[model samples]
Target: MQKAVGIIAEYNPFHKGHEYQIQQAKEQTGANIAIILMSGDFVQRGTPAIFAKHQRTAMALLGGADIVFELPSFYACGSAEYFSSGAVSVFNALNSIDFLCFGSESGEIDTCRFLGKLLADEPKLYKEKLRSFLKQGLSFPAARKSALAEYLKEKDIPFSEDFLDTPNNILGIEYCKSLAAQNSSIAPVTIKRIGSSYHETSLSSEYPSASAIRRELIAAWNTQKFLSDTLKNAQPPAVKDYLCALLENETFLIEDDFSLLLKYELMKNTPESLCAFSDMSPDLARRIYHHLNTFETFTQFAEQLKTKELTYTRICRALLHVLLNIPSDLPAISPAYVRLLGFKKESSSFLRILQKNSDIPIITKAADYKKLLPKEVHSLFEKDLFASNLYETVKCNKKSTAFTNDLQKPPIIL
Candidate 1:
């Protein structure tokens, strides 16, 4: 049987570290193929990707992926738990994957799996403890961590809070839990994240965080400097060239890059209408409604509403959904189809196998999307189309890419 390993990612812009993971995953698993289910225009962080999805998809192929699929917007913009489970569900539905590989700060498969099992088990005491923490006003993630720690202490199982703290480690644990919940046959594997931490902001390291790279790239683009010294040194040769070329014709966007439009959406809609989207608590909605005229940018608005309890990222994501008019109930549903972004021409055999074993519809040609999926699924996909159009409107002044005409843009064949 042919073996393939799956990776879930938001190659917001592919970097050296991502390339390393792909090479390591393929070599470690000895898998014949690597399939990456990547986020589309929107990402889990609740922000638009710096470059468009097709551009990033090209980067993924250049970085060493055989196949790349879009992780529908519903999951792409969700929290870690929902995002991981949604992607895992898609991979599981394929029934052709042999292993799932991801990068983590800890890099220990056993430790990650143990935490995953505990979370999935969700013993009685853990639930009580979690509810207690939630009642105390902690964020959902914090409450879950505290509850798990207390549960472990009661069981006399020593565990470090660090396991649940770091960004990559938290995501790794979620991947394991999702696999367990689905009773998936695919094995989970981990690679130690190298160079910089996820939140690192400096581009001095060989492998800076994606955040850092984006920061430098944005600075360069803003100043009419296509590739700054920092970005040139930080990225791999091909990646640096690709990004520099992209910036020459397009813009470098941040998480709240489209905040002006978001503000318009918030100001144009009733508070009640805004409440229908995810992460919009009544209190948060009221705050947003009252502050609509106070701040000029979405980032400023988010910062104004940000508190110890309400994080900046959370605020940004919530406002983004409002701008997109995304329904709050999206997370309740599974992704409707596997949207193919791009793939290597040489991977025909692998693609054939995936199509044969896949349970969901595999979308290749964008023009045939309606014909391939049900009306309801197509409606859900329209969210993706809407997101693409919004992102492109920002680039209207810049040169056009494949993303400009996503409705008819075929998947890139490299």
Candidate 2:
């Protein structure tokens, strides 16, 4: 039987770093097939993907993934904990996977497992210390780190204080925690991230961060220099060609494109109403309500809302939930179904094994939800559909093209 490894990612624009990760995952795990669980139209950072999901899916397939599954919008635009839990749950539901591979700065699976186990266990001392830090007005991430450090100190556990600082390491820890919490059989694997840091904004290295790539792409688009050599070198050949085609067609989207929609969402809702959306606390909702008059653009408003306790990405995600109408009382964790976005034609037998092993429905056609999902599951799936339609509407309006329903589109098979 063919072995498979699962990867959870956004692949916002599918760069060379991502291609390398997929290649290394297969090589390290000795897996015959790689399955990707990717974010849809929206990414975790509360921004629309630069290119559409299907385009990214094609890039993933070309980059070496056997099959690609869409992580629903609710989790896609959620915090690291929710994002990891939802993704892990989906992979767990797919019983054929042998391993879950992720890229991390630490690249220490044992350390990640230790931290994950500590967090999942949540001992009394850790809880007390965490609460104390929170009461001192520290942000959740800060509080958790401080609490964990203090708890480890008292327990005499050897660890590094900087492990929680890097984005990839933090996410990797969350993945480990999720796997532990679910008591999953799938083994966790980590590959060290190469080249630029996650937040690096300069395109000077052979493998630039996605952030740097996005910045370069946006700058090039604004200046009408669509085919820069620096940008070309940062991506895989297929992704480079796809990006060029998208640029030529003027089909790419950016954070500012949804400003009008966000403004409308803010204008109509009171602070109380806004608090109903996921990640919208009472304080944040009130702040957003007061800041409505000064709102200029999505990025600008997120900047305006930034504070010591609330990060810019958190604010953007909260505002996105408001715009998308994601409820605060939605399920705590777990995805409803596995929505296939694309696949390589040669992976048919592997796909069959996955289908036979999966516990939840694998949705290939958007229109067959009624037959494939339960009532409550269909309700959750509807949010994914609405998000896709909303994204399509924005893209179409920007391009001056007719609106096409996302449900009518078929999964990409290459």
Candidate 3:
């Protein structure tokens, strides 16, 4: 059987544990090709990815993936459902991806499937139970577990472990649901994460978590040897260079951009407008408005106010929406074209697969996007353009790349 596995990842810094997951995916699925569909400039946690798409793609290819593709930014920054949905849809289009591999604390699929069915088919009663649990002061995860227990009490469904403790497993279930909902042919596989926890700050062995790895990198300027194997194993594209680029060029400065726009938006925001920002619960928005004057930096404001139920990531996402003018829900749209990041000669086969079936243009140049897209997409394209230029500035000493349309392609820097 010929099986090709697809992965959706954000290797903010590639690590060893990630390598173990890829190895397990291939071993379990008997897959030869590992296709990674990853976030671009930003990650799921609503921060700039430690590195840009081009660098990340290069690292993914080195790590083990046979091919790398960009997950659209809209889907990349949204909820788990949208993030997984957007990624799954792209894999679905490829036609060759037969398995979807992800990391989960619980390596069991049967329990995930059961929970998924309930979440989708039994929305109202389940939601109400969950809401009731939350009103009693349970955290979201705790409330969810309590609600699930109540829903499954009459039945014999076995929740193998403390489900609330497993973040990857929760997300893994989301992936299963996405695959099933889309009716995609991809089979789901979960590799149990090893070594450190997802959000752990301390490092022990070669396979340190991404959080630990990021901290190490941020503290020290060195990368080559200092990078943990867990991250180096994944081969996240030249991250040190990227971060330096961002710092030097002031890419982190949000003035005149989304963050500034958001500051203005928040001051003028009506309760009703705040309500439209999805995760901004009615109560939370009121708190934000009441507390906006209390903090200075966005991170400071978010960290001081949020509860465990509303994670720092979720709070940052909500803030991003206010700044970027992203609507609560995004409509599905074609990529306009498949833009190449970095690919080894081996990626030729992968490109062939996409080019053969891709619905829109497959572009290697940023300049070509204007001709292919409508004016509305310009704002979206401009962000990407800025991201690309900013990313390039990080990789090279001098600014050697064009911000707008340049037909000349960047050589695949291995």
What TM-score against the true fold does each predicted structure earn? Answer: 0.96, 0.98, 0.80
Please give, for residues 1-414, the per-residue lDDT of candidate 2 as tens digits.
Answer: 688999999997788999999999999999989999999999999889988898889889988888999998898889998999889999999899899999999899999998998898899999999999999988899999999999999999887899989999999999999999999999999999999999999889999999998888878768877667998999988878877877676577888999999898899999888888999888899898888889999999999998888888889889889888898876385666889999989998888888998998999899998899988788898998999899999998888988878788888899
Q: Write the per-residue lDDT of candidate 3 for residues 1-414, one digit (tens) a residue.
A: 446788898877666676778888999999877778777776677666765566567656666666666676677777776777778777777667888999887777777766755665656767888899999987676787888787666465565448756678788877877777777678887887887888888776556787786666655443433434444433334533444444454222121123333567799897678878645677678878888777566667778668766777778777765654556655255444445565667657766776776665555556767786677877666655654554444434233433432234452434
What C-alpha lDDT values do all the predictions have? Answer: 0.85, 0.89, 0.66
lDDT of 1 at 71: 91
Off by over 4 Å in 1: 398-403
- For lDDT, candidate 1 versus 3, the one ahead is 1
What lDDT is obtained when candidate 3 is compared to the true structure?
A: 0.66
Distance from true position, residue 360, model 2, in Å?
0.5
Q: Of the candidates shown, which would achieve the greatest TM-score relative to the real structure?
A: 2
RMSD of 1: 1.7
Give every collision pair in model 1.
Answer: none
Worst 10 residues of 1 by lDDT: 395-404
